[model samples]
Target: MSKWKRLQENSLLLLPSVVLTLALGIYPLLWVLRYMFYDYAGYGNELFIGLDNFRRLMKDTQFWDSVGNTFVFAGGKLLLTIPLSLILAVILNGRLRGRGWLRAIYFMPTVISTAVISVVFYIIFNSYNGMVNQLLLKYHVINAPIDWMGQEHAMLTVILVAVWGAVGNYMLLFLAGLQSIPNDLYESASIDGANATQKFWSITIPMLGPVMQMIVMLAIIASLKGYESIMVMTEGGPIGRTEVMYLYLYKLLFPVSTGSAVDQQIGYGSAVGFATAVIVGIITALYYYLSKKMNKVF
Candidate 1:
C-alpha cells in the first residue's frame, strides 16, 4: 500500500475517538468559556456582560478564602505525601519477605471509594464516640475527647485523609520508577563507598526526576480540586472554615435554601469557576517550569 493510503486508514481509525472527545470534552470547555462572560441563572435569560464576571471575581471575598484554603490543602498534601511515598517505595524496593503483601496493603486505600473513606473517617473522628479520641484517651494522650472534624482540626483532618488516599498511588509510581533504575548504579555507588543516603540523593532521586515531576503535578491538581471527601466529612462546615474553591462554587451554583424557596447565583458561580481555571492554569505552568529547571539540575 502507498503511504497516503496507510495515513488515510489511520485517520479513519482515529476519527470516532476524535469526534467523541470534541463532543464530550472540548465543547463543554467552550460552553464554560461562554458562561464565564454571561450573567445567567441556570433557568433565566443570559446577559452578555463581557469582563464583568472577571471584575466581580476580583472583589469576591469567598473566592479568595477558597483560594487560600485550596493552597493550604495542596501544600499540606505535597509536604506529607511525596516524602512518605518515596520512603515507602524505597523500603518496598528492597529485598524482603512478604514484599508483595506489604505493597498491596499500602495500595489498597487508593482503590477504595473516596466517599466511603470519608464516611468511615467521619465516624472515626467523631468528638464523643470516635475511635481516634477513644484511643488517645486510652493511651493517656489527652484528658478529654477531641473534635477532629471541628473548625480547629477540620483542615488538618482533611489533609490527612487526602494524603492517605494519595500516598498509595504515588508509591506505586515511585516503585515503577525505582524498578527502572538499573542495579548497576547501586553497585557502582557501593564500590565508591557511598552510604544509603548518598545513593538516594545522588542516584535514586536524579533518576526518578521525571516520575517525581508527574507525581507532584498529579498531587497538586488533585488537592486543588479536592471536594468529595471534604463534602462527605465536613461539608465545608464549622462556619465555612474548610470551604475550598470547588465546594464554594458548588454552593454558589446550588445554594441551600429553607422551605419553599430557592437561591441561585449562576453568574457568580461561573465567575468563581473561571477564576479557579485561571489560577489552576497559572499553577500548572509554574509547575512545568519548575520541573524543567529541576530536571536540568538533576
Candidate 2:
C-alpha cells in the first residue's frame, strides 16, 4: 500500500477511542455550549438568555476572589515544589550509600492516594492536639494552639499540604533529567579544574534547562486541575478564604449559593465552566509559546 493508505488503515486501530471521546467528552462540551445561552433547572425547558450569565460573572466579587486564590495556590506549589525537587534530585544523583532507599522514600508519597494524604494532613494540622501545634506548644513557641484551619491561616495550610503531596512527582521528573545527562560532561569539567559547585552551575543547570521548563509546565497544569484535595480537606470554607476556581465551579452546581438558587443557575454554571476553559486554553497557549522561545534561548 502507499504511505497515505497505510496510515489510514493504521488509524483504524484508534477508532474505538475516537468514538468514545466523541460520545463522552465532545458531546458534553457541545451540550454545555448550547445550554450556556439558556437557563435550565436540569429538568425543565431552557429559557434563552443572551450574555446575561457572562455579565453577572463579570461583577462577581466571590468569583474574582476565587481567581486570586487559584493563582496563590498554583504559585505557592510551584515555588516550593520546583526548588525542593531539584535539590533532592541533585543529592540523589551522587553515589551515596542507601541512595536507592532514599529515592524510594521521597517517591513514596506520589503513589499514595491523595484522599488518604489529605485526611492525614487535615488531622496533623488540627488546632488543639495536632502534631504541629503540640510541637510548637512544647517548645513554648505559643501559649495557645493556633487554629490552622481558621480564616487567618487556612490558605497557607492548604498551600503547604499541596506542596508536600506534589514534590514527589516533580522530583522523579527532575531525577530522570539529571540521570540522562552524560557523566563525561562532569568529568571533563573536573579535568578543567572545576569544583563541584562550579560544574553544577555551568554544566548541570544549563543541561537541565529544557527539562526544567517541561516540569514547570506540568506542575502548572496539574495545579490548575487541583480540586479533590481542597474538597476533601477544606470544602472551600472559613468564609471561602481558601476557595480556588475548581471548588467555586463545583459549589455552583451542587450547593445553592445565597445569591442564586440551584434551579436557576444551569446557564450560570455553564458560563463559569466555559470561562474557566477559556482561561485554561490561554494558559496552555502561553506555555507552549514560552517553551518554544526558551528552547531557542537554551
Candidate 3:
C-alpha cells in the first residue's frame, strides 16, 4: 500500500478509541467544569451563577475539615506503609527458605479487591465482639472492648487498614527494584570490609534512588485514591470523623450530610472535584521535580 493509504488506515483504526475516550472521559470532564461555575442539580435548569459554587466551597468549614482528614490519612499511610514495604521487600529479596511462598502471601493482598479487603478489615475492627478487641482482651491488654471504629479512633482504624492493604503493592515494587541492583556492587562492598548495614546504607539505598522516588510518588498518589476502601470500611465515620475529600464530594453530590449541611448542589461537587484534580496535578509535578533533583545528588 502507498504510504498515505497506510497512514489513513492507521487513523481509521484509532478513530473508535478516540471517540470512546471523548465520550466517556473528556466529555464528562468538560461537563463537570461547566457545572462548577453554575448551580445545577442534574434536573431542571442550571443557573449560570458564576463562581458561586467555589466561593461557597472556600468558606465551607466542613469541606476544609475533610481536606484535613485527607492529608492525615494519606500521610499516616505513607509513614507506615513505605518503611514496612521496604523491610518486607529487603527480606524477601534475600536468600531464604519458602521465599516464593512468602512473596506470594505478601503480594496477595495487593491483588485482592479493595472493597473485599476493606470489608474484612471493617469486621475485624468492629466495636463489639471483633477480632482485634478479642485479641487485646485475650492478651489482657485492655479490661474491656474498645470502640475501634468509633469517632475517637475511626481515623486510626482507617489508617491501620490502609497500611495493611497498601504495603503489599509497594513491597512488590521494592522487590523488583532490589532484584535489579547489580550483584557486583555488593561483592565489592563485602571485599572492602563493609558490614551488611554499611553496605545497605552505602550501596542499596544510593542505587535505589529512582525506585525509592518512584515508590514515594506512587504511594502518595495511591493514598489520595483511597476513597473506595475508606467508603466501604467507614462510610465517612462514626460521626464524620473519617471523612476525606472524595467522601465529602460524594456527600455533596448526593445532597447528603449530617443534618444542617445537606444541599443538593452538583455544582459544588464539581467544584470540589476540579480543585482535587488540580491539587493532584500540582503534587504530581512537585514530586517528579523533586525526585529529579534528588536523583542528581544520589
Candidate 4:
C-alpha cells in the first residue's frame, strides 16, 4: 500500500475513539459551562443572568456547608488512604506465601460497584441494628449503640467508607511501583549500613515518586467527585450534615419540594456547581505543582 493510503487508513481507524471522547466527555463539559450562566430549570427557556448565579452562590449558606464537607471528606480520605495503601503495597511486595491471593483480596474492593458498597455500608453502619454497633456492644466498647449514620457522625462514616473502597486500587498501583524499583538500590543501601527504615526512606520512596503522584491525583479527583456513594448511603443525611458539593448540586437540580424556601434555589445550585468546578480545578493545579516539586526533591 502507498504511504499516503496507509496514513489515511490509520487516521480513519482513530476517528471513532476521538469522536466518542468528544461526544461523551468534551460535550458534557461544554454543556455544563453553558448552563452555569443561565437560569433554566433543565426545561424552560434559558435566560442568561451573567454573574447573578455566582453572586447568589456567595451568600448561600448551604453551598458553603457543602464546600466544607467536600474538603473534610477529601482531606480525611487522602490522609488515611494513601499511607495505608503504601503500607499494604510494601507488605504485599515482599516474598510471602499467598502473596498473589492477598493482593487479589486487597484489589477486589476496587472492582465492586460503588453503589453496591454504599448500600452494604449503609446497613453495616445502621444506628441500632447495624453490625458495627452490635460488635461494639458485644465487645463492651460502648454501653449503647452509637448513631453511626446520624447528623454528628454521618459525614465521618461516609468518609471512612470512601477510603475503604478506594485504598485497594492505590495499593495495587503502589505495588506495581514497588516492583519496578531496582533490587540493586536496596542492596547498595544495605551494604552502606542502612537499616530497613533508612533504605525505605532513601530508595523505595524516591523511586515511587511518579506512581505516588498519579495515585494522589486520582484519589483527589475521586474524593472531590464523590456523589453516588453518598447519595445511596445517606441521601445527604438526616439533615444536610453529610451533603458534599455534588450531592448539594443534585438537591438543587432535583429539589424535593418539601415546601421549604431553600428547596427552590435552582439558580443558586448552578452557582454552587460552578464554584465546585473552580475549586476542583484549583486543587488539581496545585497538586500538579506540588507533584512536580516533589519529583525534584526525590
Candidate 5:
C-alpha cells in the first residue's frame, strides 16, 4: 500500500479512541473549568462570579479539615499496606504448598466491589450489635462493646479496612517484580555468606528499585483519591471525622443530607475538585522529582 493510504488506515483506527477521549474526558474537564467561576447548580443559568468560589473555599474550615483527614488516611493506609504487601509477597513467592490458593484468598477482595466490601465491613464493625463487638464480648475480651464506627475510632476502622482491601494488589505487583529477578543473584549472595535479611536489603531492594518507585507512585495516587469505601461506611460522618477531599466534594455537588452546609453547588464543587486535583498533582510531581534524584544517586 502507498504511505498515504497506510496513514489514512492508521487514522481510522485511532478515530474511536480520539472521539471517546474528547467526549468523556476532555469535554467534562473543559466544562468544569468554565463553570468553576460561575454560580450554578446542575440547572439554572450559570452566573459568572469570578473568584468568589475559590475565596469561599479558602475560608471553608470543614473542607480544609477534610483535606487534613485525607492526608492522615492516606499516610496511615500506605504505611501499613506497603510493608505488609511486600512481606506477604516475599513469603508467598517461596516454594510453599497451597501458595496459589493463598494468593487467591488475598487477591479476592481486590476484585470485589468496593461498595460491597464497605457494606460488609460496616455490618462487621457496627457499634451496637456488630459482629466484631459481639465476638469480643462473647470471648470476654472486653467488658463493654467498643464502638468501632464512633467518632474516636471511625478513622482507624476505615484505615484498617483500606489496608485489607489494598494489600493484595500491591502484593501482586511486588510478586511480579520478585519473579523477574534472576535466581543467580540470590545463589551468589548465599555463596558470599549473605543471610536472608542482608540479601533482601542489599540485592533484592536495589534490583526492585524501579518497580518499587512505580508501585509507590500508584499507591500514593490511589490512596489520595480513594473515598468511596469511606463514604459507604461512614458517609464522612460522626461529625465528618472520616471525610476526605473527594467525599467533601461529593457532598457539595450532591448533598445527601438536608442539614448539609453547602447545598448542591456545582460551581463550588468544581473549585474544590480543581483544588483536589492540584493537591494530588503537586504530591505526584514531588515524588517524581525525588525518585529521579534517588535514581541518579543509586
Candidate 6:
C-alpha cells in the first residue's frame, strides 16, 4: 500500500480509542474542572464560589489524615511486596523441579478479582470466628482473638492484604526481567570466582536495571492509587484508620455510610480529586527525575 493510504488506514484503526478517550477521559476531566469552582451537590443549582472548595480542602483534617494513611499503606505494601516478589522471581527462574507449577500457582492470584480476594480475606481475618484467629488459638499463638478490623490493627491488616494481592503481579514482572538476563553473564561471573550473592548483586541486579526501574515506577503509582481492596475490606474505617486518598475522595463524591449518610460534595470532591491528582503527579515526577539521575550514575 502507498504511505498515505497506510496512514489513513492506521488512523481509522485508532479512531475508536481516540473517540473513547475524548468521551470518557477528556470530557469528564473538563466537567470536573468546571465544577470545582461551584457548590453543587450532584443536583439543584450550582453556585459559583471560586476557590471555596480548595479553601475548605486546605483545612480538612480527615482528608489530610487519609493522605498520611495512604503513604503508610503504600510504604508497607512496597517494602514487603517488592523484595518478596524479586526473591520469588529469582527462585522460580531457577531450574527446579515443578517450577512451572510453582509459577502458575503464584501467578494465579494476579488473575483473580481484587474484590473477591478482599472479601475472602475479610472472612479469613474476621475478629470473631475467623480462620486466622481459630488457627492461632488452636496453636496457642494468642490468648484471645485479636480484632483485625479494629482501629488499632486495621491498617496493618489492610496492608497485609494489599501486599498479598500485589506480590503476584510484580513477581511476574520480575520473572520476565530475570529471564531476559543472559546466562552468559552468570557463567562469566562464576569463572571470576563470584559466589551466588556476588552474581546477584553484580550481574543480575545491574542487568535488570531498566526493568527494575519500570517495575518500581509502576508499583509506586499502583500503590498510591490503591483503594479498592481497602474499600472492600475496611470501608476506610473503624474510624478512618485504613482510609486512603482515593477512598476519601470517593466518600466525598458519593454517599457513604458512617453511622449516617454522607451528603455528596461534588464541588469539593472535584477539588479533592484535583488535589489528589497533583499529589500523585508530584511523586511520580520526583521518582522519574531521581531514576533519570540514577541511570546517569549506574
Which one is best on lDDT?
5
Best by TM-score: 5
State the weakest 10-residue window (summed lDDT) of model 2: 256-265
Best-to-worst order by TM-score is: 5, 6, 3, 1, 2, 4
Worst 10 residues of 6 by lDDT: 253-262
Task: Locate the minimum summed-lDDT window of 10 residues in model 4.
Answer: 257-266
Report the error of model 4 at residue 228, Å: 2.0
Error of 3 at 50 (Å): 0.6
**In model 5, what lDDT does residue 64 have?**
97
Q: Candidate 3, residues 163-276: lDDT per residue as tens digits? A: 888788899999999999999999999999999999999999888887998899999998876777778877888777888988878777874443326667788789999988
Q: Please state every model's RMSD to the true fold in angstroms.
A: 2.3, 2.7, 2.1, 2.5, 1.4, 1.5
Each candidate structure's TM-score, on Cα atoms with residue i matched to residue i, is 0.93, 0.91, 0.93, 0.91, 0.97, 0.96
Q: Which residue pairs overlap in candidate 4's backbone?
A: none
Q: How many steric overlaps does candidate 3 have?
A: 0
lDDT of 1 by residue, 209-252 (tens): 88888988988888888888888888777777888998888877
Global CA lDDT computed for model 4? 0.86
Per-residue lDDT of 195 in model 5: 100
lDDT of 6 by residue, 188-214 (tens): 989999999999999989988999899
Pick the winner on TM-score between candidates 1 and 3.
3
What does the lDDT read for residue 29 in candidate 2? Answer: 95
Shift of residue 214 alpha carbon in model 3, Å = 1.3
Off by over 4 Å in 1: 256-262
Q: List, residue by residue over 1-298, the lDDT tens digit for candidate 4.
A: 9999999999999999999999998997777777778887766677889888887778878788888888998899899999999999999899889999998998998999999999999999988899999999999999999998888888889889998898899999999899999999898888889999998888898899888889999899989988878898888776778788988887777766322344444555656777888899999999999888866875
The TM-score measured for candidate 4 stands at: 0.91
Q: What is candidate 2's local distance difference test score?
A: 0.86
Q: Could you tell me the lDDT of residue 292 within candidate 5?
A: 100
